[model samples]
Target: MTGAAPRLRSPPRNGGVRHSPETARKKSPPPPPSSSAGGIWESAHFLKWTAADALRLPVRHPIPCVLAASLLFFMAVEYTLRMIPATSQPFDLGFAATAALHRGLAASPRLNTLLAGLNTVFVGMQTMYILWTWVIEGRPRSTIAALFMFTCRGILGYATQLPLPQGFLGSGADFPVGNVGFFLFFSGHVAASVIASQDMKRLQRCHLARLFDTLNALQILRLLTTRGHYTIDLAAGLAAGVLFDSIAGEYQISHKLNH
Candidate 1:
């Protein structure tokens, strides 16, 4: 390994899209507007779907809209709470008080591994949900911007020496798992795209992107309003992990298929 970065392969297509009877039966809807920055209140926003819409989606599979909205809220709450003066709020909580939540949930090695794995999946599933939304919403420009920003931050985990909030990047760290967060997030981000674009599987790609764009846009607004760097960073680590893992997962799948 000479530090060469892995190049991504464009997701392949099965056959060129041929409108079928089903396509012809349904009237083509009006093109969706360009997604605005996400917020719960924004009507035209690409990422912000209503609670009703989410409830309507089948829960058998993970939903990006729900995950993004939930993560964004958690980030906003935990981070904002810490900013309140201990004297005023009577809570000595720092920005990362939530990390302690992990302490209680993790038990034996098996439980620890389970939590770590689920946390990683939760992050990626959220990303995938957002991607799914973006695709549905006509592939707005904001989708690309959010993803680009996420990718840059996610890759930085490899070069940065600073102690990450999640802790477990290398070992002997507060978070023995955080060491790998960057990889999980970055790879998950790329993998989400690859998964959505897989050959004939491209059916879901458009919807996914639309959903993601709206969710991430709202997340930005939440971050701005709350200004919780630690909380946001913690949330980001999870988001980032999902992106990385998704990418790694895709690569494995692709490699398996190629061989």
Candidate 2:
């Protein structure tokens, strides 16, 4: 009994289990790293290297840099140029392209008349092709695009009334009745042709699309020569056609999803 007093045991510290000093030291987290000048210099060097790399990229890809330079030049010109008077007609570089043709039209009414007739025929062709895509070919996207474009054109055209150009050649055979008066901010003819051409391309009718593109170029030249539309008008018309076609495709997609 009292021979060997029961061996005594120590209670666990800090919880159920006690760890040795060496184990505790190993389990503890390391101290935070000190912020050193070398680290700051390394970060600065990295940023500088990144910036230099980005700068060199434009050297290899010069088109974007050229465009940026051109933009800056134009901005400088715009800033330095005098404001045009309210009554004066602003000069247009696009008009310069057809300057001779414009003068020719002014001098020869017969030639103007003939060109007008041809333009009318082209208009008819665009109409027929557009309708054919919808009514005959069972593809309605082109027609829908034309409708959307015209609706938007009407709204914008009526909102701001641009005075007719000085030497516009009026034609009885034009799309508008007698070419007496119409919207001058956007060319429906060009927009319609674009719509039809885009539809042809989508349908893999490459030959027809190319034909339409060629005719569109000629139509653009004629419109510019006759002053049927302003340079901005034709440009906007092309953009509008592409925009409306995209809209039509989106609408068709949404409709299908809903169904």
lDDT of 1 by residue, 125-232 (tens): 555544654677653332453455456765665565333333321222212244433332233333333333331133445665565544444433222222222343
Per-residue alpha-carbon lDDT of model 2 for 1-259, expressed as tens digits?
Answer: 4587787787777877879899999999998665898777776756666767877978788998889889999999999999879898756667888999888888888877787788788888988988888898788888899889999999999999888876777777666758677998888888988998898888899999999889888889988888888999999989988999999999999999999
User: Candidate 1: which stretches are off by over 4 Å?
Assistant: 1-103, 134-137, 154-160, 164-232, 235-259
Worst 10 residues of 2 by lDDT: 43-52
lDDT of each: 0.45, 0.86
How many clashes show up in model 1? 55
**Worst-scoring 10-residue span by lDDT in model 1:** 167-176
TM-score: model 2 vs. ground truth: 0.78
**Given candidate 2, what's the lDDT at residue 55?**
79
